[model samples]
Target: MATKSLASCIFCKIIKGEIPSFKLIETETSYSFLDIGPVAKGHALVIPKYHAAKLHDLPDEYFADTLSVAKKIAIAQGLENYNILQNNGRIAHQEVDHVHFHVIPKPAASDEEGLVVGWPAKKPEMSELKALHEELLEKLG
Candidate 1:
């Protein structure tokens, strides 16, 4: 069954035209719009029309459509470099309950306003890696 909008969701309000947004594109299952709190000039957000709190909670077709719209936004913006970010839960920095992907177009490397990430690399034992990989593969089955 198709999901319905959550009445209290800000994104749902945007989708329903109850709230105004700088809309870029809209498909049967997804909607793309310019972010009011953008990280860069062409920063945009692609969201499924259906209200899904997490990525895994969304229907497969809706999730796929959301990603497809994000790609289209990047190409339309003429972005050579960009970041697609989706936070799943509150612990992962998800402020909004709706499932949305951020399509942030990167500027020059020196520009700090774009997508910035800190990767703290750590090398783990081969056995640890193998165990985790096996666990994930089993879950995927």
Candidate 2:
């Protein structure tokens, strides 16, 4: 069955040509466009044509194209250091209901430019990690 698209989705509208976008590249399964509200120069977005609210909701077939397109955009722009970001839920910073990847270029050493992230690393018990790994492995099987 074909995946149903939300007509109200902004990305869907862009895909349908209803909305204008600064298109960078387009493939059979994905679309790439320059971000209008860029955090840095050469900031772009790559999205799968198949509309899904979250990454887990998307099919495996659509995965390769999205990453490939993102790679092409980064290569074409000569981005040496950059970030490929994807958010799932609203609380995780996903503003759009459609799954998309952000290709943010970190051109300079200034924190003011590009993606700035705070890594709050925590030390957990090795036993906890081992238990979680076993649970995940069993689930995978």
Candidate 3:
């Protein structure tokens, strides 16, 4: 569970205007701010104005608007490609409890910066894969 953590979270301060931010864009539903401690050159975080611990906690309308705002920021910022990342639980590396989307601009295959994704190879057998897929579908439903 996400307790109210306004005491030390920088993101909370950004929402409250207690700290300054290099905000690139803002909307009625969301706000896009540059990450001062960034992983890439144009690293930014898009967040809903209303505090929510996770993405799923937000209303569908708000989620859709957040994506739209993110796309606008990407275009205005000259980001040809980008990634939208939202973490949920603490085990998923969610440092901040508020609902935020990481808008990491994909480098032009030259800067060699952006979200690096990889996983150890574990080729599951066809039967195993099929069973797991079915289980996931049922769980999702």
Candidate 4:
């Protein structure tokens, strides 16, 4: 793979041992760490050792490995419920550029600091919905 932008990227520094994170697991393809700013207790972020700013940019191997790490953490963390969130781009509210999956452990009663999932309005105009569906289909196929 080609060299990636890692100069000042936080995750890169974490991978390079330049920073410290609450590391849960590490493997050849991916690294898993507890989120310092977690959505909930045991909330973790899993990412590839290689840099990628968005989900589509991520290598399949790395994505798979990251998910594997997340699953293990979920079970080990004793999560009653969980959500896997991977956002991209500014519009998606992805604060970090690195492609990371948030493994959030949500229970019946969540702490005030934890993530509370929200579903935005799905009431788009028919034309807008159709156009978006077509575009996504093209990309998928």
Candidate 5:
């Protein structure tokens, strides 16, 4: 498991108030703030107080507060349409090493605003999917 890197982690610095941020909500286990560079006007980020590079690395206890804060931010912003995004690594578009959830509001139906996603979905044989599902179930158990 990854340990907290308080001294070197930027998110940790923000949480400790060593770096200034446009603060939104602060909970016992999470901190939320406005995104410095927003794809949309109400884009915000919620992060767990415990430092973790990925969601799977985070302590289970930290999850509720992180998700709850994101929900609160979305509701407070009155976002009718939005995307709650969490990226696991650099290849997945995670710029910061700390685990975070982005609450990006879709204020308008424009390519210029909000997160624009491309879904290059692929269809696989049902037998292949069944085998994958069985493998995952066994691992989960």
Candidate 6:
């Protein structure tokens, strides 16, 4: 079945050639292009041709293809270290509704321009952790 495109989505427009982009890679089911607002020098965005607002909404094949293209781009850029970031919803800082993956190349661990993640580790009750794990497992099934 052919997936419907989102007329108002910028990524959809780019895929349709309605908008111009500095394309990096074009695959059978995905498209990669340079990010206009890049955090690093070789920052790129890979997105599926199908219009999916959330990552889970994408077909399995589309999701796989998107990641494959992202990996290819990373290799081509000679990126030994990089970050693959996917934001699902607004709360996760996903400004764009279309599902896309960010491939950001990092030169060093101290590179301020690259992804800086902070982990505030807390000791949670075993019951809480087990409950969350069970919920996720149920959803996965």
Clashing residue pairs for model 3:
none
User: lDDT of each structure?
Assistant: 0.90, 0.94, 0.79, 0.83, 0.91, 0.90
What TM-score fits each model?
A: 0.94, 0.96, 0.79, 0.82, 0.95, 0.91
Model 6 residue pairs with clashes: none
Give candidate 2 regions above 4 Å deviation.
1-3
Tens digit of lDDT per residue, candidate 2, span 1-141?
Answer: 355579999999998889999999988889889999999999999999999999999999999989999999999999999999999998999999999999999998889999999899999999999999999999999
Better of 1 and 2 by lDDT: 2
Best by TM-score: 2
Candidate 6: segments with Cα more than 4 A from true spot: none
Residue 83 error, candidate 6, Å: 0.3
Q: What overall lDDT, based on C-alpha atoms, would model 6 receive against the true structure?
A: 0.90
Lowest summed lDDT over 10 consecutive residues: which window, candidate 3? 1-10
Worst 10 residues of 1 by lDDT: 59-68
Worst 10 residues of 2 by lDDT: 1-10
> How do the residues 19-136 of candidate 6 rate in per-residue lDDT, one tens digit apiece?
9999988877888999999989989999999899998888888977888899999999999999999998988889999999999988888958878877789999999999999999
lDDT string for model 5 (1-141, tens) is 233656889999999899999999997788899999999998999999889889999889888888889999989988899999999989899999999999999988988999999999999999999999999999999
List where candidate 5 sits over 4 angstroms from the true fold: 1-3
What is the model-wide C-alpha lDDT for candidate 2? Answer: 0.94
Q: Give the candidates in order of TM-score, highest first.
A: 2, 5, 1, 6, 4, 3
Error of 3 at 23 (Å): 1.7
